[model samples]
Target: MYTLNANEAKTKFGAMLMKVQSEPVEIIKNGSPVAVVVSLDEYNKIEQLKMELVKSRFENIDESDLVDGKTFREELNAGKYD
Candidate 1:
């Protein structure tokens, strides 16, 4: 990972764009990270993986085992899944 200040990112936008093709660049504002620049391929791959993970997790949610938010919290607090 590489980090660049706001001014550095604006002045060197083109260079950063090229660099992001190979790896991510974190843009910092006031010494705090605010944004990430990544290649389209990398961004797409991340989105696809996130979608797959959500789908897999939802697959375990049985409609027949449905519970309200309060009941769900109670069950979690009771460590039923464990």
Candidate 2:
């Protein structure tokens, strides 16, 4: 990862775009971190990992613990979880 100030990033936008293809670049402004630039492939990989995490967490759910939408809404309105 590489850090670049706002002015440097603006002046070297093309180079920043190229560098992000190889590694993430952190943009900072006024000495505080602002944003991270990443390649499309890296972004997709991160999204895939997030999806896999969600799937793994839900895969072990028991059918008996499931509730219908209407029942859930009713319970929510009744403050059952409060």
Candidate 3:
């Protein structure tokens, strides 16, 4: 990871962003870490992983029954089991 103070980051924003594209970079303010910058590919990979996790978690649900059923809130309040 690379650390950049506010002034340094402000004066060299483009270079800092380029550095982050190769690895992680940390922006600091008042001697404390404030934020992280990551490459777009890394960000996209994280988003894709999240979607896969959500899809797997809901894989057991029957798609046909999802549209056929009453509203979700109604089913929940009715103590229905899938």
| Highest-TM-score candidate | 2
lDDT of each: 0.94, 0.96, 0.87
Q: What's the TM-score of each model vs. the native?
A: 0.74, 0.76, 0.66
Writing each residue's lDDT as its tens digit, candidate 1 over 3-82 gives: 89999999999999999998999999998999999999999999999999999988898888798999989999999978
Output the number of the lDDT-best candidate: 2
lDDT of 2 by residue, 9-80 (tens): 999999999999999999999999999999999999999999999999899999987999999999999999
lDDT of 3 by residue, 1-82 (tens): 8999988999999999889888988889999999888999989998999999999979887766564345877877788755
Enumerate clash totals for all models, in the order shown: 0, 0, 0
Q: Compare candidates 1 and 2 on TM-score and give the better one.
A: 2
Error of 1 at 62 (Å): 1.6
CA-RMSD of model 1: 4.1
Better of 2 and 3 by TM-score: 2
lDDT of 1 at 10: 100
Any runs in candidate 1 off by more than 4 Å, and if so which?
67-82
